[model samples]
Target: MPISNSSFAFLIISAFLFLSVFQTHGKVIINTNGIGQHSFADMKIDCGKECTRRCQLSSRQNLCRRACGTCCARCNCVPPGTSGNADVCPCYANMTTHGGRKKCP
Candidate 1:
């Protein structure tokens, strides 16, 4: 028995379609509960919500990190020891102060 040309073409087409579908679908495995038992196609969708919540909590005015003394000197925010006077805080290192503008120490 000899394979027909149409049958051969059909077989090739079927194989190509099968391969294209298989290659397009991908799986991502996520380990949850510290036991490696979770599988997810999109972990970021879940993790991102949690991350946003945590960031919001941390960015609260009272919860924000407060640096003072020399540490404040390096910060871009209000410089150290000048918390009472924003006018005296340094803007950037090597920058000059003019007309009450702050200069980096």
Candidate 2:
């Protein structure tokens, strides 16, 4: 058996389509776990909800939530717990205030 011109073109086009989908979609699937240079940069999260949860343990809950929200908006990650889990999100962990204090809760 032999392949016809139309069939050959179909295979080539199918391969190209498969390759292009993976090439473009890889970025959308990868680097969304908050552990890369992109670091959840492509993810859409509710900062208000995450910040509220993050600030639950703070004595100054409102202030903590405000700062957490800022950090979450910038970094797109809110650590993992109410406090002291900044290692999980380096961007959130590393952000600093102008006054030389930690910015995120």
Worst 10 residues of 1 by lDDT: 62-71
Q: Give the distance in Å from residue 7's predicted Cα in candidate 1 to where it truly belongs.
A: 0.2
In candidate 2, the residue pairs with backbone N, CA or C atoms under 3 Å apart (3 or more residues apart, or in different chains) clash, namely: none
- RMSD each, Å: 19.6, 6.9
Question: Which residue ranges in model 2 land beyond 4 Å of their true spot?
Answer: 1-35, 38-42
Q: Pick the candidate with the highest lDDT.
A: 2
What would the TM-scores of all predictions be? 0.27, 0.64
Error of 2 at 5 (Å): 30
Off by over 4 Å in 1: 27-105
Per-residue alpha-carbon lDDT of candidate 1 for residues 1-105, written as tens digits (9 for 90 to 100) = 999999999999999998886566545443333433333342222322322332343444222232122223333233223223434323332344465633322
